[model samples]
Target: MKNIKFLIAGILFGIILSKTQVVSWYRIYEMFKFQSFHMYGVIGSAVLIGIVIIQLFKKGIIKDYLGNQINVKDKKKGFIRTLVGGSIFGLGWALSGACPGPMYVLIGQGALSVIIVLFGAMIGAFIYGVLSKKLPN
Candidate 1:
């Protein structure tokens, strides 16, 4: 299948996340408690890498699978929205011990408990979708 590559890429990413311990609840706890630099360092590296990739996209150095230049949209400034949304996300991550991305990895690693977190995330996303129109733009 043409989509097999994407599945492979996802598996690779999951392996990296697992091996780096980025998906570890202990690492997450350390990050929240400011008790260790491991997670912070990983996050900082990711931010730096994201900045570079975004710049590449903006400069037309990156292209989609269809060979079209990737479009980068300017984000609208919203401090209150960001604060509230980030706080909620952080609370969920702290309590669930896994970010949404790693929820699948947790499951793959035999953490059936993460099904509860995945369910909660899905429900939250659905609620947000329903309320998005009513919320601030």
Candidate 2:
């Protein structure tokens, strides 16, 4: 029964994404093409929410859903690695017309064609997991 809540939440989230048109491929294309601000506005709002949540975690004012204290840790900084990763991620997003989050939502919204994107993402993740130890930290 505990997992039912998560299932409901996911359904609600998928509905919100559909109603907001965030799952639209054209919206993503417009964002990549710099032809519209709609997608940017949506992304900026999410960033703001994430910032607020991180700040709460940093201040010890928020806990996980399981009631454990949130711990924010500083990780090693690698500017070149970050730039490379961001470039690759952006390229993939532009090519696929869907980022990681919206990929499943697209499938849920009857975009069966995006199955290829999802499959590619899974394979990429598997490759990353296999290669992560050999890559820089």
In model 2, what is the error at residue 11, expressed in angstroms? 1.2
lDDT of 2 by residue, 27-50 (tens): 988898899999999999999999
Residue 12 in model 2: lDDT: 92
Clashes of 1: 0
RMSD of each: 0.8, 1.2
Question: How well does candidate 2 score on lDDT at residue 119?
Answer: 95
Looking at model 2, the pairs that clash are none
Residue 42's lDDT within candidate 2 is: 93
In angstroms, how far off is 57's CA in candidate 2? 1.5
Best by TM-score: 1
- TM-score of candidate 1 to 2 decimals: 0.97
Q: Write the per-residue lDDT of candidate 1 for residues 12-93, one digit (tens) a residue.
A: 9999999999999999999999999999999899999999999998999988777999889999899999999999999999
Provide the global lDDT of candidate 2 against the true structure. Answer: 0.89
